[model samples]
Target: MNRKPADTEPVTNAPEWTVSSLSGALKRTLEDAFGHVRLRGEVTGYRGPHSSGHAYFGLKDEGARIDAVIWKGVFQKLRIRPEEGMEVIAVGRVTTFPASSRYQIVIESLEPAGVGALMAILEERRRKLAAEGLFDESRKRPLPFLPEVIGVVTSPTGAVIRDILHRLADRFPRRVLVWPVRVQGETSAAEVAAAIRGFNALPRAMNGPTGPVPRPDVLIVARGGGSLEDLWSFNEEVVVRAAAESAIPLVSAIGHETDWTLIDLAADLRAPTPTAAAEKVVPVRLDLLAAIADLARRHRGAMMRLGERRASDLRALTRALPSADNLLAGARQRLDLAGGRLVHMLGAGVRRHEARLAAAGQKLARLSPLVLLERARARWATAAQGLGRGFAHGIERRAAILTRAVSRLSLQPLRLRAEAGRERLTIAGTRLANARAARLAAERARVDNLWKLVESLSHKGVLARGYAIVLDSEGHTVRTRAAVSEGMALELVFADGKVGATAQGEGAQPATRGRKRKSDAAAPPPVQPTLFGGGE
Candidate 1:
């Protein structure tokens, strides 16, 4: 068999790519194929937003799952935020993450799937607002019986406004402030809310371009009938909150009577129609006038009847009174009887005075001055005797008290107390002295132990154990022989002291050798070990 040369090799046509290139190609292909798509699926694995303000989640159906991401800007603009288990239709471009080698959808816009989803969202919002007490009946205000200025929030061109105006005219006319706004669309809710707030912000009455613009006394938010989607603006949280926070009474007349919105719950009154809102705000002018007239007539008649009844009572009282002549006849008879009794009373008084004079004379004789003086003297003498006896008894009682006090006064008990106090003082002083001595001893021992520990850990201890340290002229430790050079200034520190010397090369001999030999020959000096090496 013939083998091909080593340099000769067979080659086939095939494309080559790096991982990044392949990923890029795949991403471009996927994006070009599905530039934009609307996918309806149930959201899953939604764990809210990341710290980066971007949201990550998965959209899955019964069988398949696709990763989804919402950029911060896009997520903030979304009307309906994606929640776990929520069914929504996402509109965005299909893209790939090269790092993870996965395909995902970059969501730009998201919304609930259909009417069912919308209803679910609506119910959830209702429950939330209700929990905040915004929809409570107690929070609702009563509509003004007669509003001077009425504000209508609706399209000025719509028939609803015309109906309201005509009805209000038929009943009691009022100043109407029309805040024209879009009835439906993306800006509908915001426009309506602004209109409500604008009306509230207006001064009670302010000058306008054409004429005076009076702030609305009663606000009527009215619109013609429509489906739930068309009427959804009234159900927005902004519009409902505006109605709830309205200072002036508000009437909600949106859609047909059967169609309910959240604003109706917060409004002061819910009219079935625009015309009904008008009727409810004001009473019928003619009927009111007629009622007033009837009341005036009844009041006048009642006052007249009261006056007549009082007059009759006065006449009856006058007829029942006694005749003046008859009254005078009785007075004359009493006067005559009084005159006859006056003479008899005068005679009896004189006789009674005589008897009183006789009794007074007898009392005067019995109370003579001499007899009174004698009686007073007898009483005085008796009192004097009683006082003497009392004084004598008081003196005897005081003497007995003095005798008892003298017996209780003694010196023996005081001496015993003084001795006991002295003994207590002595014992206290001895205990205090012992305690002071013990504290001083303990402190001394502690200080000695600390001093010993410091000595053991210090470098001085190493020097004392026959070890010496060598330092350069700069006082830096010379740990290796290489750090030394010929003629270098050196320092040697031992336990006893530090010595300065000039370094000599290894071949140099010691200067003290001759002196040391002479001394050694005379005394035969015992050998002594140097700090690092023995003498040569």
Candidate 2:
């Protein structure tokens, strides 16, 4: 304890260290010792990017742990950012923070430790989206039975588009709208999502450069088979969400049958390949035509069966009905018996009326006017003396009446009255004749107007427009080409007259009656390409 000045041997010369200098020296030594490390450890203590966009986290294994830092510039360039509890491989320089005198790894790059890490991230995302009900069966819609226009989201030059086009052409040709996009890489998810929304943004029907740009009734998001990382674009949340929210029914054909992606869950239907998606979108044209023909045959057979049944019933009813002669026999017999009794009944009625008339005449004779005349004569005799004066007064009154009649009577006045009556009769006759003539003229005009209306409304007026009515031998309309056959009798009624003709053959094409226009020979519309460009 007392050997400080002379007892100890002379100490070797050494430089003094300040705290900062010492810390700096240690930092340099750590950096020099482990210039860069490819450390594999589980990421911990990562909340997120700091305010300055730097990331500070810890890398820990079961045996040990170290502080790790990703600077703002390096973090921005990282493809995979550090997540808490994510096992990652970090390549970085090891140095000490002089202020705290602590050593940390300054990471330059970071990636998942292995495929297992990527799977972990994928499963976590799947669970999150599933919890939000994005992958529910109820949310999935049915693919259109036949999409007139099919929208495809895929690479423009890939075999997938060609296969889909070929398959669709083989089954049922449909107009295809291609939205070319990158199938993989950093920007794949965004491009694919934008393609889906862009398709949805198109009008249901609109005119484009060549023709109509009809919105797809159904969509196909497709790509050839590839590894999980290659197909990871479809599994991205943005892609999955776009598929889930699409109004158009979506079919996902991302990979081979064994391969699947998040889009497969979100899509309305999933196909093993692009060709299979084409098959699901439309039915075979030939098969549809065959089915329609079969239905037509069935309908005709049903109608014929019904007609035959109705005819048989009618025959049976006709046989059960009585003849007209049989029904009228009893009525005829009753009418003959009544006719025989009519004369006797009329004679009996006449005899009863004659007896009633004779009784009335006998009563009238019993109350005759001779009895009243005799009584009147006896009364007149008793009043004869008083009547002498009355008789004289009557003679005087008759003489005065004769004198007045002679004074009033005049032939000239009578003749004038008769002439006036004749004039009035003549005017009345003229007026009656005029009224009759006007009535007759109005009736004749009405009849003429009605006849003109009938002529205008007749079917002959339609024939006057250079059209002909074709009638079969049985006077039925031969409306369709199928109804005509070789040696079939036909009647063509034109404006002036009708002509009878025979059909030449089944394959004969009806000649065009009128002159053909130049536009009738114009070329057909151009075909649209199956794939569009602009893919990366």
Candidate 3:
């Protein structure tokens, strides 16, 4: 049913609503409109994964920011952990928080909006820190062999502390100074960095109001494992710089072994977990005890050996001791016995001498012939002794004679060699003369043969054999018929001399210049017989 407006002016009729009513209606409208929104935004002012397992953070774009929450159930089921400044796509219902009087997204599902974007940001930041040399392996320090006090920069009330403390207790315990700081949030990175610098600034030898200004020998910047965004605080430039610049040997234990952050690279040593960091900081009590026992055993054995060696030396010294009187008495006894033996040996020697003399007397009769022979040998030796003078004289005379004969014989040998050399020289001279005569005769015979051969091959020889030699007008010999032509003046070389004549062709007649000699016309002159060419 429609009711009419009750007003003086019926034309101005608008419904009125209370503020609470209007707000409620508006909230409902928003919830219905975007009941399940899949919004993509970068997380801002993220502060949760708190004790209650709920996340409270703001999602913001360049234009605006809205409150976002992740309930325990939703967060537990999320594949990625929430972190500040992380871009994420949140699937949830838009609901109004009347108490805070702000509208927020009650997130039912959350995921990394863009892995590529996240990784790109991560890599960029990584390269930036690396360029600053924060991630250099050389700049990292070694963990203290045994830090008296360990300063940890982390959440004091978190499981990370508990795990570290429990592990320290289990292994070799140390005095741990917990510089409690929020492990995650917008300001977490700054707070953590401040804590690290503060620990470094502590006096090593002085006590402070809080018991001691703990200058920790080693530092552990640790955290429970989370997503890359959740662990981003440790990767922050501030946090990484703090870790790298620490004088204390820092041990980075950010997450599980698989999880890595920039701090891990910058730290001197990186432990896989808080517990492992505790384990790495010091050695086990039982192991130290075992080592001490081994040392003690070896020391005791060495002492015993030394004592035994000293005892052996003492025993040998004690045995070397002797009484002076006893030594003198022993020497006297030995001397008296030696005197008695000497007297007895002398008496025995005299008896042996008498016995040998009797035996020699009995052997003398049998050796009488040998004695006669010795006498003869002595006579011969005496003669030989007397013959020494004569023997030397005879040897000298014989040597002189032999020397003279040898000298003569040496001269005869030289003279005989000279005679033989002279005879050989005479024979060589005769042989040389005979060889010279034979060489001359052979040379003369070769010359004669060569001359005879020359006479047979001469041009006079050819003319005498009835062959005429023809010469051209150039005074050149025309051996071939082709060299002369008809009407060419040529010289005809006969046996006696050259005759000038005219060349004629084979069909032309030869004209006689003058009458031939009577003897030449009758018959060719008979060849004269001679031993050589010119003579013949």
Whose lDDT is greatest here? 1
Q: Which stretches of candidate 2 lie over 4 Å from their true place?
A: 1-12, 16-35, 51-54, 70-81, 205-212, 306-536
- Evaluate residue 304 in candidate 2 and report its C-alpha lDDT on the 0 to 100 scale: 100
* Best of the two (2, 3) by lDDT: 2
Q: Cα lDDT for residue 370, model 2?
A: 38
Instruction: Predict model 2's lDDT versus the native.
Output: 0.80
Error of 2 at 469 (Å): 67
Candidate 2 local lDDT, 420-528, one digit each (tens): 6446645655665576567556644644454455456556778887889987654545666756666767899899999999889655454432232233223232221
Candidate 3 lDDT by residue in tens digits, 439-532: 5576457555655655675556789998887765544456555545678788888887788997765844343332223432233222332322
Best candidate, TM-score: 1
Tens-digit per-residue lDDT, 22-70, candidate 1: 9999999999999999999999999999999999999999999999999
CA shift of 437, model 2, Å: 71
How many pairs collide in each candidate, listed in order? 0, 0, 0
Model with the higher TM-score, candidate 2 or 3: 2
Q: How do all the candidates rank in terms of lDDT, highest first?
A: 1, 2, 3
> Which residues of candidate 1, in runs, are more than 4 Å off?
1-13, 45-55, 71-81, 207-212, 316-536
What stretches of model 3 exceed 4 Å from their correct place?
A: 1-113, 306-536
Model 3's alpha-carbon lDDT is 0.76
Candidates' RMSD to native = 48.2, 28.5, 43.0
Please give me the total number of clashing residue pairs in predicted model 1.
0
